[model samples]
Structures are given as structure tokens and as C-alpha cells.
Target: MSSTTSNIKFNRRDFLRTSSLAGGGLLIGFNLFTACKPNAKPPVDLADLNYKDFNAFIKIAKNGAVTIFSPNPEIGQGVKTSMPMIIAEELDVAWDNVYVQQGDLDTENYTRQVAGGSQSIRFGWDALRQTGATAKQMLLNAAAAKWGVDVNELSVSEGIISNKAGETLGYGDVVEEAALLEVPGEVTLKDPKDYKIIGTDRKNVDIDKITTGKPLFGIDYKTEGMVYASVLRPPAFGQELESYDASDAKAVPGVIDVIEIGDKAKKLLAGEKVNWTAQLSPSAKVVVIAENTWAAMEGKKAVKAQWKFASPPESTEFHDKKLTELLDGKEFTTLRKDGDVQKAFAQADKVIERTYESPFLPHNCMEPMNFFAHVTDEKIHLVGPVQTPEDAANTVAELLGRDVADIHLEMTRMGGGFGRRLYGDFVYEAAEIADTLRKPVKMVSSREDDMTTGVYRPAIKYRIKAAIKNGELTGYYLKEAAINGNMYGLIPNFFPAGAVENYQVDVAKYDSNITTGAWRAPYTNFLAYAEQSFFDELAEEMGADKVQLRLDLLEKVKGTTDERIQYSPERMQGVIKKVVEKSGWGKQPEGTYQGFVAYYCHNTHVAEVADVQLENGVPVVKKVTCVVDCGIVVNPLGALNQIEGGIIDGIGHSMYGNYAFKEGMPEAKNYDRYRLIRMKEAPKVETYFMENELSPTGLGEPTLPPAGGAVANAIKAATGKRVYKQPFIQYDEIWKVAEKPVLG
Candidate 1:
């Protein structure tokens, strides 16, 4: 497919025409015909399109095919299918005719292209529907004018505009005329009851390509004359490059050049203004212009290098111990204070206090981080597995001291993101290396590099206390100490902060040798684990049902508190009720262990129940029952897939996940050492969505937080001892706790 500049020439006139056609409201015209041919090349200068200003476009061609320019990246969360479902609902089109394309980094048409935070569906719920509604209205108006009838007398079905008088026109027959109409500013979106496709199950748009090994991932991205690149970072955080011997590397076949690209030097001399929000650390050495990825790997292994460790060397153990000590101390900033905790504890019939600890986690996305860039004096073209194109474009422009308009960042389907791709550190590295070598370079990270050098989920420790008097919960206290280094700086308002009255919360931090970034639900990941576990403990002490205990607490705090709670109690209760009914919470099979947990995040509420059994002293998850309330479901199958994936991932982290540091460096370098969940270990997942019409919310990260708590609860049921720490009851260490009785 050839590139076209029609968008530029048809800008203002097209916008006004489409708006006028859509009942005199503002409208945005998108070229839907672009999706007709596969592998269509985007216009060279279309990178200048404003993504933040307008939502992406979905156009229907005359042949009933719908093309969607997806602003958000599809990183195994299924936005490619779900986002298109939103448009299809309002366009009144068949799903078979829908086609999805990766949108260019056009700030004019998209916002928050970053795929983290599970915000894709929540943000696109209204915008994508409006885009489709506007187009559909324009087509109907064109048909009405042709048939000399009122538009209200016409309706659209499967890309056909038909009138009550039996006159009809296909979308293709009126698209040229509709394209000439002014874009409507206010298109009436169809109500949820009228939706034909939004709530329906649909297959993933790229599943066929993925399962067949089509070139849809960054690892498969290739171009002629392109060379591979790699970097050697310090084994430990805060360590700096001292010196390196390149003689052996130069002798390696296909090796081209070894360059010292220090982050400090670039900050000072490259005329690039670094944005710390991007979470990039200083890189001291990078090997570029290699023949292939394998050759680059061999050359890197052969190169001799040395590093200087940071002063006052800090390791993961040091940081973990320090955080534990600090939590034991009395001095900490109080985030919440309600009733007198001292009095409540003194008068309580029972006081339960428990400390929970979780280690740092690596994203370990199926696909490792990689980016390909071709930088020159005139312009830069970048493409790869990136979640945020706008941020990438801005950072690349700043790093190269080029116009943001000249730096183009194209997104590819990511194997997975899980908040890891939010940090564009890898993008900067690729762009800088490409600029220096003046050739196209694909910077690839080995599994080891991706696991160790990349940003990690912060290690956290939580101390929770609850008071119960006469089988009635009175007060609660929670204090959390975690590694507060990296992007998302210390967010003290994460959870349990504004949710409870007569409660106290404190958050503290200790610096660590590990570099950290967002993973899945960010602070919510651990907060859910701690808070939900505390609730379970409280329920046991109060002799109350677990679900009933949560419901009562939610009711007690309703409307009598602040507005910053960040969740809807009704919605939370709805999912809990749904899960309870579906999982048969009160009834149990002989020798089966059951655990339940619920959480709210990313504007979505999720509740999960896990059934487990002990096999050879290892916790084996048998099945997971999940209930999600994300408002209107964009794509039922995609939503279900996300929940299933999240549960599997969360189980892996709770049972087998760990990133250890030895002598200030990561001990688990690759999959061999760092374990992951495989198909043989996969448990049966049953997911249900609560029906609603309040617009869609996020699905990806919201389901993850509950998995850990549910699995932990199930393990506690299976074994009499409560496991507070993650990777709970590892098989190698199960013998140490064997004296503890296994409970039914």
C-alpha cells in the first residue's frame, strides 16, 4: 500500500464538513480506506499529527470493511480487539469486516497512548464510540440527502443506510460525499441497549498472526541494512563503568564498533534535556553495528569490562533489612488518623497483628524489550515494542536535539507490557545508538539483561493491626515500608489511606541497590495483598463470614467519609456477591481449600476465589473464579482473556516469583533461574462480567491484585499456618515448615 497525504490536504475542510453532516457539531474525519490493504505504509510526515487533540479514527469503506487506527498499543491485553469493538458498536458494523492498524505517533489524535495502568478501555470508551458515531451519522445524512428524506427516518445496519421508504445505500456509495461533509461536533452515541457488538464475545484481532509466528512482535521486526546493537550495564545498581578491553570483541566475527555512551556525558554534552519521568538511568557502554543479534551477544560475552561499585554499597538484603527495621520503629509520617487506636486496642476482646512481606518482581514479559531506530540529520524513524509513542517521541527528540515533529515513533504489538513498557529507557538507548552510528540499529536485550537491568516491581513490607470487641471490629492500623526509588515516586495515597475511618496509615521507604518501576497495578499489587489478608485475619478473630465482614465495613463507611476513597462500595460489593454466588463459597468439596479476595483499581472492581490442594507439599492452584465489574464490556472474550492471564501471572508471582540480589547484583538472570508460569501448571479460570452501562473501565491490571491474596488465602486454608511472605512455602523449604499441621 502506498502512503497518502490526503489527511493534510483535507484537514480543516474535512473536519467542518463531517461536523456539519453530523448535525452541526464538531467532527474529526479519519481515512478508513487505509485499512483495505495489509502492510500499508503511513505517510512519511504524518508523524506531525496531533495525538493529544483528537481521538483515533475508524472509517467504513464502501465494501462494508471497517478500519480502525488504534491509538493505544496492544500488549497482549487485547486492546486491538476491544477498542475496535467500541467503534463497531456505534458504527453498527459486523465484526468480520473490522480491521485494526497501529497508529503513528500523532499527538493530535490520541492521548495516553501508554498502555500501562490498564487505562486503554476506560479512556477509549467514549472517544472511540464518538468517532464511529460521527462517521455513521455522516453516512446516514448523505443517504438522507440522496433519497430526499429526513435523516431521523433512516437507520444504519451492517454498513448500510436504509430509510423507512425502502431506499438504501451502502457505506461505500456515500463515503466520498460523507467525506466532503463537515465533521460533527456532537454525534449522538448509541445507548448500551442498542449496542450489537460491544458486549459480545470476539476473537483477538491478531491471534492468528501470533499463533502462526507472523512478524507482529518487536523481536520479528526486521529491515534490510539494519544491524543489531546491545549494551553492557553494571551488574549492580549505582555501579559505574571503570574501564573495558575491546581487543577480543573486535576480533569477533560480525562485530563492528564498541562505543562508550555514558548517561552523564549525554546529559551534559548532548544538548538533550533529560526528562526524569521517563525513568532512564545512565548507561556507560553500548555495543552497536553488529551483523546479527547472535553475533552481538557473542561479541558482548567476549569483551572484557570492569565496573566501580557505588559508595556505601547497598544491596537488596541491606535494603530489605533496613525497611524491616524502620517498620519496627515508631517514627513514621501518619497518612490517616481517625478514632483513638490506643483506646480501641485496650478495650478490644482480641487484637490481631501480622506483618506481610513481598520481594521485588520483574515484569518478565514473554517478549524482551527491544526498539529499532534509524536516525539521521533530517529525521528519525523509530519502531518496536513500545507502549507509549508520545512519550517516546518527546524523549527521542530531546535526546537527539531534533524537532519533536521530526522524530517519529511507531508502535508494534508487544508480547506483554504489564506496566514495564511505560519506562522508555530502552527507546532512548536505541535512538542514541542509531544517531551515533548513522545507521539503522535494533537494540535487543537478552533475557538476562531484560530481567536484571530493566526496572523492577518494588519490594514492600506491610505491618497491619486490627481490633475486635465482642465480635465487632472497632479499629485498624496499617504501616507500609517499601523501596521508594524510581518512577511513581512515593505515592502515599495508594490504598487503605482514605478508605477507612478510625484507622491509621503510615508509609515509609528505604533506598535499595535495585532499580524499580511500575509493575502491573503499582502500589495496589502489595496493598491488596496486605489489606485483604488483614481482612481475612479480622474475619477469623471476629467469628464473621469473610464476605459479610467486607460488606459490613463497606456499609459502615459509606457517605460518612471523604470523597477520595477511589472506589465505589456498591460496585465492590456487587462483584463480591457475584463471586460468592458463582464460587459456591459456603459449600465445599471434600479436601478442597477455598480462599477469597476483592480489590478495586484502574477504575475497575474485581473479586476472585481460588480453590487449591497440596500436592507433594507444594501449593497447586486447582481453579480460579473471578467476577469483574468494568462497566460495559467492550469485548467479552478479550476481557475474559485479560482476567485469565492476570490470574495466571499473579499466581506465578505469589508462588514462584522472586528477584534476589547477591553482592549488590541480581542473582536470577534468566528464565532458568527466574521461574515463570507454564501451561502444564495453568489452572482452570472461570471469569464473569457484571452487566452495566456506565461506560467501560480497565481490565488488565485490576484483576492482578486479587490473585495474590486469593491464592494466599487458599494456601492458609490448605495448611494451618498462614504464609505472609510471597513465593509462599517453596518446595525446597517446605520441610522446614513440615512440623506445622496440614489443615482441611
Candidate 2:
């Protein structure tokens, strides 16, 4: 891991300049593209308090209190904390003095304010560092000018500047002068080794709010003269609203109005290009508006609605059979083909193949889908917990036939996203409801509503085959069959691509009415389990250690066509080796079954080992060791929280999470039916971060992919039975005869 710095040049006109606050303070604005341009007018005039002019920003009060605006949505990924930490670190400010505030959607200043793909930290790194560095440089120059000393002779630490003569000044004392100084042309970034706040542990800035149940989540949003809306969506995926009688709903106490809103499909099917985010807006649904949430919910329950199939209804059974048939058929698209796989398999000594299957899954975010919208003739104001606020605003704008400039979106903390909030359909629906009533409305989705009528993780099947020749691995082929969509765009270039000489990847998809989109790591979530489990079997067939087998394959990938690879082989190997040493792989005590898996995705490399103990013949995950190489963790505490959360989430869903559809209706409406990992079942996680100078990648998703694989392998070691399907309890025989699990 090497440290790299951007040599950004900034002229007086293009530098990230400062402004005098309404109060006696300094407000610094940073824009990576235009703010640091060589020759251009500054994006924002340094005379006013205009916040929309910069992608990243810092405000220092005269009393030394610092406020940093986090430009990305905070979906429990800790960006609100980590993003500001970067600025505070470079600003040489005390961590205690820093206050982080979530910034509203300002496309004029921000780029990539999205929360998906685990890229918030990676993409915001350089600009955020430069923002603080630029501010600090200006402050240093101000102190130098006042003290009649060279800037190079001044040293600053935690908002205090000192000279060799022992004279000291607080940053507050010089902030006014700093605001008036011209921005430096170039600013130097601190070396990674000199970092103080980045590598050290820092608590989430919102931890207190979250734990204390403050009004930080979108579900907690409220406004005056606002009505609550509960919707009645079509029960089935292919169903369309035909007629609705709101007589009973209107009779309910506190009920105000019931209205039907048409789906965006009309515009979507017009054969005209429309906003992609708006395409996910809901189908025809009856909205019940009332004075309160309880009234709205009750009114919705009382409403009588009639639905008819727009097309053929789909079921899990139909999807499973169709996907299986697609796997056996010749109709497929070649995503990637490295060599002649057919020829390599022709003369093979042995061929092994396996198919893995997973059911569709709902996100089931803790805070059920909800958004507040105020629609008037002039503007549309939306406030919610959305991952892509910019996209949400655009989607609303498109759906309402309004200009994007007239839509303003504010982001509140999300209880959980897990890729669910990436779509702006809910936001659009809220705006539609409010626009129809010409008033402010807060739309809420019941747990059942979201579970049954929501964007889901598409059900998928993978057929993976490997051909061996003379004890050497020769060919590898993977065929993916999915409902609605295929693997993610970049997955074809992931692991085992550059490692195999005759590697090939093919995919086929069934266009179903069931809506599907990104779910956490997306395709890699289950693909990792399928591929890593297959690799374990491949290693066994080759009479090699599973861990060593991965290392050997990575060795072949290193330096050979490395540029095309999405992940670093060295980083992958580093985590693998670290997890092995830390977990004492192959040296576990008696009755302990250990499984190892290494994976790379979300621009991060991770290796995990699950330790299983059979409790009354049922495999119990007792502990897990996870080693990550995300590089220069901005906040070790937050990073640890993400790793543990990812692993636990992965294990929970892989073990008991099963959402089935029968005749286009979700089997489980809520947690009463859907199973989740219990507190007693959670494994004690030992987390370790591979120290490196490389820029940080993503931690929110990468660790999750390997968790399922490691746990499944551990169960196999414990029971000599392999599980190929998600919700492992359904496929493994040990779970069939085992008594109720009891915590050890």
C-alpha cells in the first residue's frame, strides 16, 4: 500500500476560497473540479454565505467550534462521521470541536452524492482532504502575516498555532484574517504516517442521537399542516388496480381523502427515454390520506379495492423452473470469454459442476419506507431517508412534469438502506400524493406493504463448471440465470477471470413483472457464496488446502493482465494470510469446525473464517474472524461496526432469510413470519484491518459477500453435507432432524 497525493494547482481565481460568515467566522468552500482549476473564476463568490457553491465545506466559528457538512447520505455507513473526520484531520482541528451536519442535495456543488456501491469514502477522499488542507494553509498564512513571521516557521495543532518564540494564537483569533487572505495556489497534504484522526478510533457523530432515539431518521420527520398517507398497492406483482371503493375508508375517523394515482408506466412505455430513476415509481395504487398515521393505516385497511392481472402472475416455483430451464438451454449472452473453454474441457481428465440457487429477498429496512413531500405550484419539497437524493429529486421532477430545479430534497438519517433506498420510487410516490392534494403529505409504507410491493433482490441460479486435466485446473465456465436482470456490470471481470486460462462467463435473464434492483453488494452477495463454495470443492478435488488453493490462483493472476482486474491480488492475498494467522486456521480445538473464504468486491478485499460448533447436531456459528484491507480506515470504530454488521447481516440472511412468492404474493408480510438471526445466535466477531497506505475503499458491503460462504463451508465441515441454496436451513440435512437450537 503506497501513499499518493494530488498535486492540485489553485490560482487566486480558482482556489477553494473562503467567505466571511454573517457572524465573525470563516466559511471555506471546496470543489475538486472548478474550485481547484488552474484558470477560472471561483465557483462561489467569497463575499456571501452561499453553501451550494462547493462539494465539500467547513465553517469555523470565532470560538473555535467547527462545522463540516457531509455531502453524502448517511445510511448507517458512517459517512457523516468519516467524511467530516477527513476534513477535521487536515484542518488540524480537535475532534471534540467538530460538529457534522448532513448537507442537502446540491447538485451544483456535489458530484456522486449517492450512497450505493460503497464508494462514498473512496470518491470523496481527495477533495475532502484538499478542502481541509486548503483551509489550513489560509489560516497559517493569516497567522504568519499577523506575527510578521514566515509561514514555514509556524506550526499548528488542534486549532492552536505556535511559533518558536512561544507566542500562540487560537484559530478563532485569526479566522477573520484567514477569511480575508487570498487562497493559496497549492497546498500540501499531510503524509499518511502523520495522520492523527484518520486511523484512530472515533465514535459515530450520531451515535448519541441514534441510541437515544432522537428524531434523526426519516420516519421521524414531521411538519405543520401535514397529512399522513397510507397506500393500498396491488397485492400481486402483475396486478393492476381496476376499481376502488373508498366509502368505508372515508367513513373511518380522522380520514380525509382517498385518491388513485396512476403508475409511471404510461410514460415509461411511451417508447421515449425517461429518467431511469422515475421508471421505478409505483404502479396504480389507492392512497388513503388522514389526519394521523394510525387513521391513514386503518383507512387503508378498510378500503375495498379490486385488482386484475395486467399479464401473467409469477410465482417462486415458476421462477425456479424457468431459471433452471434457462441454465440448460442454449439461449445465453456471453458476458466474458477468455479462451476456448470448450476445447479445454474436451480433453479434461475430470469435470465437476454444481448449481447454486437463491430466493428473492426483501430489504426490510428497520425504518419502513416513508417520505415527506410538500407540493405546490411553485416548488416540490421532499424530505426523507434516500440514498440517492439527487436522483430522488430528479425522479420526482420527471414524474410530476416539473423542472428539476424546482425540486428540493433533504436527507435524513436512514435506519438502514442495504441498497433499498437507491431507488427513488417511494420518493416519487410521496410527491405524487402531495401534488394531487396540493398540500404537504407524509407517505408511509407499512412493513407488509414494503415487503410485498418493493424492489427486491432478484432470484438467481448459477451453474459453475470446472475442467481438470492431468491434475491441473484447465477450464472454468459460469452460467447465470436470473429473474429480471443478470449479474452486476463489473462482476465478469472479478475474481477467477484473470486467474483461469480458459475462463468464460455467460448469463440469461427472464423478464418478469417482479421489480428488482441493487441489494447491498448486488449479484456478488450470493455469487461469492456460490463461487467460494465451488472453490472449496475444487481444492478438495485437487488435494490442496482451500486457503492455499486461492493463494495459488491469485499468484497466477498477479502481474499478468493485472490492469484489467478490478481487485488487487496482493491485497486479496494479504487479508487471506492475515485471517489465517489470526484465526489459527487448521489448528482449531476439537468440536470446532472452521471454514475459510476470501473475496474482493466494492473496491475492498476481505477474508473471513467462521467457527462452528454443533449444538445438538445443529451447526451453531460460535465465532467469526474477519480481516479487511480497505486501506486507511477513516474511523476504525466505524469500520469495525460496518464489518461486524455486514458479517452478521450476511449470516442472518443466509441462514434463515427466505422470501417466497406464490401467485405473485409475498409469503411473509413481516417479521412474525420472516425469520431473523436472534441475539443468542449472533457470533462473536473478531475484526482486524490490514494496515495500508492505500486510499480507503468500501466496508459496508465487501465483508458481507464472504460471510455466507464461510458459514456454509463451516456447516459442511460439521455435518458432511453441502448447502447450495440460500437460507441454508432449507437445503442442509442436518437442520432437518436437528432439535431446536440451544445457545452454548
Candidate 3:
């Protein structure tokens, strides 16, 4: 939980000058203070806003309208609205009085422009509120100076300022003067109890626009002179473009051009200044540009390209033998170590051992990948749904031989990001194609391309061993092996890390040519499924209550003076007991079986009870009672929606089974082959958050990690079977039944 992280400071920047409205109005160009970059520093003196290098534009119209620009990317995580709410709330403005606008990536002015890590709210929770409070204080200062009264004697409500003497001033009346006021070194924040908008149920700023199809997503983005383009990538991971004949592609009716994208094109533009070929790229592929999306698709299909397959030295195959060798290996890099684990296991009355595995899960975001870029001779303007636009812009600059100033990255709403958008390969490819064609280009990816050409979630295997002596847990050891990238690096010691007296966590890894990126909860998404399921098995082994055993471990952690425990044991116990009580843990409906699991991730503690029933051979989740404590919930409705979505997302993956790879290529290329939770299979999810004054954490990812285990344990309760691997739809196979469970 501890490492080198720069102290975050607010730095804001505006992409465009504050465009004035028709009537007399104030275009407030507030400076962004600290950058979002890790090494960025806070101002030496806090009293002045002029010292920082970021910008956020807020406008107040003569008609008393206010628009606050949101500085982070919105990838359907509800950040486009939730972030502005903190500002509006602290400003004491009516919910209806404020307008929300998504802003561009300004690294000098913003930190964490990307939306992964569930940090949209966590990243700027305080600075955003302070922004609103600062505005309010400035407005108050302006009104007081105009009225010849002390600021303390004046008060404001819903953008209206008043004095005891009955003088009144609208926010619009003083916005001009307020803009001139200096940002104070300090400002007073309202008490959590007095918050008018923080906990209130307000619609998303773009709800109406989204529901009516009036608002635009990245895939829906368009320009007057934009051309459509699609890339033809190699079928598998270890293949690159060798040669291609574009004659058939160019012969298509609306085909504009066939662009070859490779080391040659990149080196020609970037020269030796940048490692252009090593940067973000969809793949080394050929681009088919056309007048329409249909033409681009047809033209791409007609383009026949030969590929050079990677030799054994470059290829990675985890599905077969390599995984077994890595998992069964003894040598490892010790990440966390405590008391002697060997002695505890040797002396224990009982020793439990199990291995759990998860396959490479493609993001399979609802919207296929796309980015719109216009790289002309002068400046480069790239915009679309990228989770990390700032990084994308940097990559584009390296590829196009452009300056950061010349490159402008705008984030549009995304249908679903999951974690795929974090890599700007799509954006880079779009920029490359546009730069080559000398025109605006919208790069589109078919579902097949999206699934096939993914930095998929790394396939991981966990070997867990626990020692129990005289019916009491003693020691634990976990060796997690992952193919491809970093695992348990950011979060070490893990959950049971501090829960046990003698504990150790070791990591083993193997090289992979297949790319990998963060999926939902990443490690926790699979680790929790294994660890918590082991606890249930342990509960049965020790003759302890399933829910009581978790509470006991947390209670032990609470009493322990362990310095490594970063999470609060009280918080863990709070959610566990709350879920147990809420879900009627001891009394289940006659025909329904139940499962329990709890986990802490992304700084949120979540406990879930999945109530399920066996329909034929398939396990159907009937209802899920979820209790979460993510500090304070930002938006109850939105948080509930997130919890519901995550639980169902996990259930869908668990029941349908996730991605499978063969010959280093994903077998499930699209939804037809891939599986997702259908609406008919969705269980009713009841969600609740504990009352707390802690700054808001995140919820979108916490529920998902525990969902798979909860369902797996429930399947154990329904049919005394242990399903180790996820997509437990294969459970019936444990009995070697004539018919497998029908997932559909």
C-alpha cells in the first residue's frame, strides 16, 4: 500500500478559450494549480492561483446560468457528471443551476486524466469541492464589497446572496467581479451533514441527452469532412504484416486509399528522435480508407495480406504446457514474508491446498474501439473515447512528429471502457491513418478485431496453502503465478496478509508475447474468487459458520498489532455483519441456496451474499444482497447502478466462462462466440452503503471481485461440488454427467 507517489496538486487548463454566450456574461478562466503527473509539485505558496499551470473554464451567464467544465475523461463511469457535482455542491448552487461539460486532456493542468483505477472521484474529491467553495467565497467577497458590508455578515443560498438588511445579489450580478478576486490560501468547507447535493438523488447531467440519443459517444462522433477507415490486422499475436496487395481493396467503389502501417512509415516520420515503432499501435497492419464505414469494412476484407509468424522464441502459448510448468515451479520472487510457514504446515493437524486459475478476459467493451483524428500539415486534433487521452496524445505526437501543443486530445463518452481504452493504440492508429491520407479519419474496429487484437487480461494461477492446528488457523502461504505482467506489485500482503500471524505471499512469472492490460479488478477479480472460496471450504473443514469465520479473521486482524495491515478491520467486520444480517444469512428461502464473500479493493470494502437456485443443471442467481463501504457514496443511484452492473458482469463471466485462447489467439472473437450475462439471467441486486464521513472511494470495481466467489460458493451449497475455475457453467462436468449445464 506504500510506495513512491507524488503528492497530488490541482493543475487545470482549458483547451479552447472560454467562448462567450450571446448576452452579457462572465467567462471565468480559472487557473489549474498542480499537474496530474506523478512528479508534479504543489505551488510553493498556496495563496496565489497564478503560480500553477492548469486551466478549467467556468462560465456564468447574464441569465444566471453556470457551466463547469469537467477535466477528466468520461468512459461511461459517470465521471462527466459526478465530478462537477462536488463543485456545484460546495458552491451551494441549485442542482438545476449548474451545467456539466467534459474537458480535454491538459497534463500541465490535470493529473490522472485517465479514468481507470476507479479514481474519477478519488483523484479530485477535495480539490473539486474546494473549487466550488473558492468560487462561492469569491462571489461572497464580491457581493460584500459592493454592499459595503463585512463578508461574514452576508450569506448565500442557491446562487442568491443576501444580507440581513434585505439587500440581494444574484450570482450573475457579481460573477464578473468575482472572477477578479484572488484565490485564497484557505476556504471553509461545509459540514457533511449540511451537504445539499452530495448525498442527494440527482440525475446525471447528461441523462436526458443520453436516453434520447442526442448526445454523442466516441463511435458516434463525426466531422463534416471525415473519412472512414479500418485496419486489417494479423489473425494471431505472433504475426506481423509481411506484404499486401491493395489492388483489390483500391478497386472497391468508395475506397479512398490503402495505407501501409509499419516500421518504415513510423521511422520516416519520427526519424531517430523517438522510438516510433515501439509506441502504442493497434498492430502492424494495413489501413483501408473509404468514404463510409461500410466501404472501409468491405475494402479491408478485400485486402489480402501475408504475415510473418513469430518463431518459437517470440511466441507465447499459456493454454497448453507453459502454464503448468510456471505454476508447478518452485522458484519464485518473494514479495511478502513473515514467520516460518514450513514449521506451521508440518505441525498442523490439517493442511489445506488448492489451485485456482483465470483465463485471459478480453475487455469486450460495449462499443467497439474507435478514435477520430485529423492530422493535417499544421496541427493535429485527435478526439474520441480514450481512457488515457494525455498518454494517447503523447504517443500521437511521437508518431506524427508533432509537438504536444500541436496535438489536442478530446475525450468523448464511451459506451463501456472496462479497461481497454487505457491503451491509446486505437488513437495512435487513427492519427497514423489520418496523417497519411492528409484528411480527417475515423478509425473503426469490428468486434472481431477488438476481441482478437486485445492486450487481454493475463492468465493467472494461484497456489494457496493454509495450515490449521487444533481447529485454529495457523499459517498461510500463497504463490501466485501470472503469465505476461505485474501481479500483486501495487498491492502486497493482500487481504489475509495481515489477518494471519504467519503469512507469506510469493510471486512467480513467465514471459509472454501476448499483450496484457488491466481488466476490472485485475488480480482481485481472480484472487478473491480463489481466496474467499477457500475460506468457505475452510469453514466447512473447521466446523465454523461461513459468515462467522470471516468475521473472526477480521476480528483477529483488528486485535493484531500487525504493522502491515493497511485496511481497517472494523470496516471489514462492519460490511460482513451488515451483509449477513441484511441477506437473512441463517434463513434462506426453501428452494434457494446462498453464498457469502467479502473483499477490499480500490479502497472500498464490499461484502456480498448471492442467493441462487439450481434450474436443471445450471446455477441461477436469484438475488444478491450487497453491502459496501466505499467511504461515502458519491451518488446513491449511480453507485447502486455500478454495484448492479459489476455483480451482473461478474456473474455473466462466471457462468458463461470467460475468454479462451488457442495458438496464442482469442477463440471468442465477438459476442456470438463470446458469452455475457443476458437480461433474462440478471438477478435482483439490493445494495446499501454504510454511513461514514470518510472521503468517497470507488465502487464500480469492488463488487465484481467477490461476485464470482459468491456464486461459486452458492453452487457448492446447492450441489456439494467444488468448481475451481471460473465460468462455473462447467460444474456439471465434475460429475461427468451425460449433459453439461445449458448456459443459455
lDDT of 1 by residue, 4-117 (tens): 111212244433324232322223444332211233322211122222323566655555566776777878888878887877777777778778887777765455566666
Worst 10 residues of 2 by lDDT: 42-51
* lDDT (C-alpha) at residue 273 in model 2: 42
Find the candidate with the highest lDDT and give its number.
2
- Residues 473-576 of candidate 3: C-alpha lDDT, one tens digit per residue: 89888877787644454345457777777888878777766778678876678888889889999889889988888888877777667655656789989999
* Model 2, span 1-744: residue lDDT tens: 323354665665444345657677887775665533345222111112111223787888898889998888899999999989999998999999898988899887676677777776776677788889888989999999999999999999999999989999888889998877777767778888888898899999998988898999989998999999998988988888889899999999999999987655357446354454554533578999999999999999999999999888888999999999999999999988988899988989989999998889999899999999999999989999998787677667777788999988889999899988877778877888888899899999999888988889999999999999888789999999999874446667888889889999999999999988778887799999999999998988888889988999999988875555778889899999999999999999999999999998878899999999987677789999999999888999999999999999999988877888999888889877777888999999999889878778888998898999999889878877788888876532323544343111
Q: Model 1 TM-score?
A: 0.89
Alpha-carbon TM-score of each model against the true structure? 0.89, 0.94, 0.91
Candidate 2 displacement at residue 637 in angstroms: 0.7
Strongest candidate by TM-score: 2
| Cα RMSD, each candidate | 7.1, 4.8, 5.4
Instruction: Tell me the spans in candidate 2 whose CA falls farther than 4 Å from its real position.
Output: 1-6, 11-18, 33-54, 263-265, 268-273, 279-282, 731-744
lDDT-wise, the better of 1 and 2 is 2
- The true-structure Cα RMSD of candidate 1 reads 7.1
Please give the lDDT score at residue 240 for candidate 2.
Answer: 84
